[model samples]
Target: MTPYIQVVTTVADRTVAERLAAHLLEQRLAACVQITPCTSWYRWQGAIEQGEEMVCTVKSRRDLFPELCRAVRALHPYEVPEILASPVVDGGESYLHWLEQELRPAKED
Candidate 1:
């Protein structure tokens, strides 16, 4: 398994996405979270639905995926929030290293 990954999830609005992102970063569950505005179409409760959504892309180590999911779920408003993780097959060495560093546990002072 790749050591790096990106977790993807969608929220009803930008504000929710921002909060989740901030929480994830503060908890050290993700190195960085990027929010994007987009339109999504899906079937929910047997009905077709379309709406504006903010996509959150969380970058971090693969080992932190579970914690990241849990954090997102906690802040997410939807009962069933979309949480998906994908491996980063390739990335700049400097960027990958930075990501790992950001997710590292803070040393005791």
Candidate 2:
């Protein structure tokens, strides 16, 4: 099993944020997701741009990152979504275990 980590991505709007979070959690791609509204300023097409955005902080296992990235790319509206991740070195063991279970795909007996 891969270690757990947090993945961060920003969406252009609140509706997209909600939808993406739902899709990730529903598909077991993420254990939890948080959405925060913020203002983004960056360079786009060689020009400075600013806009309101919703940042999605996703938590899941490292092994699922590739799958999660692919999933995000498929549905994301931006030409490039900020898909970044950081490792979780330590945490409450019980909570970590719960995260693992929460993101597990259901099995058929």
Candidate 3:
């Protein structure tokens, strides 16, 4: 798998999603964040619920997942926010290069 990943999280509204996206970009934790309106249905507190939400798809390196999750949780209003990451197995070389350039440099151990 590639070192890149796409982190996804859902917020209650567009405002929250935009705030989260801006914060991630400002912190250099994400190369790009795409926000989309969505309808989510899930089980919460033993009850099935549905709502309108905004999905934030973040393009970032896998190594930054931990920090990214922490930042998201700090700003997210939900008691248990959804922070999921999926490996980017492949992508366009030019786009990947741009992604790397936009993100913070990887730290050395």
Top candidate by lDDT:
3
Pairwise TM-score winner, candidates 1 and 2: 1
Candidate 2 on 46-88: residue-level lDDT in tens? 9999999999999988878889999999889999889999999
Give RMSD to native, each candidate: 3.0, 3.0, 0.7
User: Candidate 3 overall Cα lDDT vs. reference?
Assistant: 0.96
Q: What is the per-residue lDDT of model 3 for residues 14-76, given as tens digits with 9 covering 90 to 100?
A: 999999999999999999999999999999999999999999999999899999999999999
Itemize residue pairs with steric clashes in candidate 1: none
Instruction: TM-score for candidate 1, please give it.
Output: 0.92
lDDT of 1 by residue, 38-97 (tens): 999999999999999999999988777777888888889998999999999989989977
The ten-residue window of minimal lDDT in model 3 covers: 1-10
Candidate 3 backbone collisions, by pair: none
Query: Candidate 2 local accuracy as lDDT?
Result: 0.89
Model 2: residues >4 Å from true position, as ranges? 105-109
Against the reference, the lDDT scores of all candidates come to: 0.88, 0.89, 0.96
Selected candidate, larger TM-score, 2 vs 3: 3
Q: Which candidate is the best by TM-score?
A: 3
Position 20, candidate 2: lDDT = 91
